[model samples]
Target: MVVWNNSDTMEPTFILRAFPGLEYVHSWLFIPFCLAYLLALSGNVTILSVIGTESSLHQPMYYFLSMLALTDLGMSLSTLPTMLAVLCLDAREIRASACYVQLFFIHTFTFLESSVLLAMAFDRFVAICHPLHYTTILTNSVTGKIGLACLLRSLGVVLPTPLLLRHYRYCHVNVLSHAFCLHQDVLKLSCSDARINSVYGLCIIIATVGMDSAFILLSYVLILKAVLGIASREERLKALNTCVSHICVVLIFFVPVIGVSMVHRFGKHLSPVVHILMADIYLLLPPVLNPIVYSVRTKQIRLGIVHKFGLRRRL
Candidate 1:
């Protein structure tokens, strides 16, 4: 097992373990890791730039896309330094303070993403269910308020985690299973009683992500009812098609999160490698895939991307 570089002091340090039994191949792992990281960064930046430049894309739905892209960028960058350092340079040690900061950004971005998805679902709901009132309901000022509310909600929920964690004492070897710090992973290393931390964490997840997901489902349910009321089959298909990209984004974000939760809850018998890999997927996959999904599924985004890349004439 990897060991911590320092003793368990007031300000402890933790070692970030990459794939177990693959230390010799750690350097080689950088190739795929860097590629994925770069892909995530470039993809999200392209999404943001396209949305910014395309005047026609300045509506509520695209505004929400920009928010998601920004969240992805924040998430990807949060894990980049430690991941690269651990994989390429064998610099596995991280101070508790820095770890807490990373944990803050990761969780904050995660909750923010969930909230943004909920907002997008509302966008779809308005567009399909109340077509005549969509513009009236989701004006530029209203959308900005919605985005600000999401940010404040995520911040309010996650700001206390690090402070709460500071009260716990670490007696276990402070080696994290993954390259980056997570709230649960950090909580596991606490020697002090952490029932409160665990409970608080669970409660916030249930309140924020859990509730957001439920509301998103409710919105879609209402949207389906609205769509089915449409007399024309073609019109129904068109309305449903508008939601495909958001649905795909939701799945990619939540499925891996569910996988990670299940692994933590029931997969104690599994290898540490399983936990680490699952965490990485939960962190990296959505950012890398969200832009690709939107670019392919939403014609406006696809056209913007093609024009930005100067591929409009060729393709």
Candidate 2:
């Protein structure tokens, strides 16, 4: 009923489907995706530039924001080429090596985002709960160390994924469900037993994102407690106000992730486009929305942007 090819002899190309039932309008789909890419790239780049140039913003919180911007930039660049090829030129065949590379970056930045968000929550916790010690606690060296640790943690965990995936021989339908490669999507197309991949993938999510989310929640709970302890309502609101952007970033990042997971697990009977769009949203939404949320919610960041772009007089 089935066959598996040897790893060495397998053809290493996959067809990336854009919209399963809406292929006729593939030409038109290019415009929105192109605009999304442009927005994600420009927004994240502007945030990074503003943070880098604004001396007053060079603190732990902004450092974490810079990390978030860098992560979004990485995600945008990771998918941009293949997405453009698929949507614009109708070029969908991605080689296995290339696919694995893309998968690595996509997943790496995903975990990096989780780690950075956790770090940001901790930054907030310290800034709110112990304002006197915030500077000494999260000094420049300490922030740099934390950023390095996040990068190392993400890389150390994700490095084995593509290697393990490469060992599996893919001999069945090589059509990918989305325009980009994902571990789960690619693994499903393999003819070999992928219990190891599946289990490892699950474990990594639980260990990384799961643990990070729990810690973030604990940080917020402590933040809430700190805010409530303030004597005045105005003080409480001011303390909580600083967390709005991080909370928004966290929601946008996690909501679509949960949506994608739910769709993959329970939406088997639904249209393929639903799955594709969910996955696309999960990948694209955070990067496109993070800078917008920050720019809108954080006054310091807004001022930094204005000063960096010489827009104060214009406005």
Candidate 3:
């Protein structure tokens, strides 16, 4: 039997486990995690700098790319400190208020990434299907508004999560499943009825991830329809080629998300290591891969990077 504590009298700190059952190798695990963080940071920052400095990349697609880069940076920064502490130093205790704050940023940025990906999909749709009106449709003013809307929507939906969790009393087990705090992970530790939290969480996931993914797919369908209508096969391939990077990014973001959700819902009987590995992959893979995908696939970005490093002359 488990005992519940009163919210008013409960301790303020919660322990975070890097891997609850597999703690012996946590120090060893820090090497790859640290390398991933460094790569993600350097890759995203390079993309941002390249995009910002290159006047040619001032178009709508690159604007959305910059937004993606920013979200990746935020996602990486949000979890970096907690991850380092838990993996390297074994410092796992975090205050309730701090945990809530971290949870807010993590979820916000995650949703923000979804929103940005949807925006990028729209940008691709406009570029491929209606090339002439792309500028008019996604003007600087309009792009700014869309970016603001994404940020605002993410914040509005995630803002209530921490507040709701703060009211729930946690029982004996306050150890989180991962190095960082996630809304779902934190909610599970609460002893009180968390139907509200769970319901809200499901609703937000459906509203943002579900809705954005559906629309992104719709956009791609329209893009495919447009591409197929082209008279030349070469032109059709060329048109589809532009979307390969975005498609890879969408898969990188959503596949892990779906896997994590599935694991949470149905993998309870599985090892704790499976859950931890899935969660870490969901959080870490996008930031690390998004810039790499874009840098390799987009010519302008590649040239910009080359020019930035004075490698153009060498090549």
Candidate 4:
């Protein structure tokens, strides 16, 4: 969600330099970000720990389930430091190479998270949509393979970005305008033409996040058709209920990400600060909100947490 400031193109500085000074964010921003960063980490960790500590959760479903939680934790943690710095200090400053590196890993994790979610959606589709073959189809071997594939898919596609960026020699206007180094922002800083980076970046998006999202949507579409055909009213209600939480999660991920990207790309001149704020909000929203949505809507998860934590059942 970082904005690329091309206004400094005329400046006699290194073309590919990072922000020299930190733009200290206001206290208000810091307070929320501090809480959000902590919550995102804590919530995801709690889920991962729950799955790890409880023997009952050692099944294939929970393995992928825990993986998703772990991916979320990593994704959020990757972005939080810079975001928090943006919130806490008036000036946001990071080294050029470090900024780009941070950005690369951030995108890498983001891609991994999307892929994991797609796998989880497939798990749900198998369990609910094809109950008979669920165990056979989603065995330990299969889950492991899928997990490895997700990792490789993300790394394979996104690895080229940093490599490409490194090749481009940054020559004036070294300082980045945004708080974090984004590919687009970094590309914008390049004095040289960046057609290759742009093409690769787009391809990476299509391969990683875009492909994962398409599969997730397809899984749901099949899920919807399958659930709607159930004869019993109670059964239909139950099926719908099962998907409600995930639907919310998908919305949370799809809406803000696409929205912020749209705004950042087209709405650049409208309000750069708003652009920055939207990017921050979009990036953090899913991590902060996913646990809340799931807990509130999914009784099993909520009760599992309580049971695992030794809490009394509540009405």
Best by lDDT: 1
Q: Candidate 4 residues 26-128, lDDT tens each?
A: 5565677788889988888877777777777777767886777777787787776666665565445565567667778878777887887888898889988
Candidate 2: worst 10 consecutive residues by lDDT? 1-10
Lowest lDDT sum, 10 consecutive residues, model 3, at 1-10
| Deviation in Å, model 2, residue 60 alpha carbon | 0.8
Q: What overall lDDT, based on C-alpha atoms, would model 2 receive against the true structure?
A: 0.91
Q: List the residue pairs that clash in candidate 1.
A: none
Q: Residue 180's C-alpha lDDT in candidate 1?
A: 90
User: Per-residue CA lDDT of candidate 3, range 66-110, in tens?
Assistant: 999999999999999999899899888888899999999999999
C-alpha TM-scores of all predictions: 0.96, 0.96, 0.96, 0.87
lDDT score, candidate 3, position 133: 89
lDDT of 1 by residue, 214-248 (tens): 99999999999999999999999999999999999
TM-score of 3: 0.96
Q: Write the per-residue lDDT of candidate 2 for residues 1-315, one digit (tens) a residue.
A: 123344577656888878877878888998999999999999999999998888998888999999999999999888889888888888888888999999999999999999999999999999999999999999999999999999999998899989998888887768888889999999998878999989999999999999999999999999998899999999899999999999999999988988988988999999999999998898899999999999989999889888877785543
Lowest lDDT 10-residue stretch of candidate 4: 11-20
Q: Quote the lDDT for 184 in model 1.
A: 89
RMSD in angstroms, candidate 1? Answer: 1.6
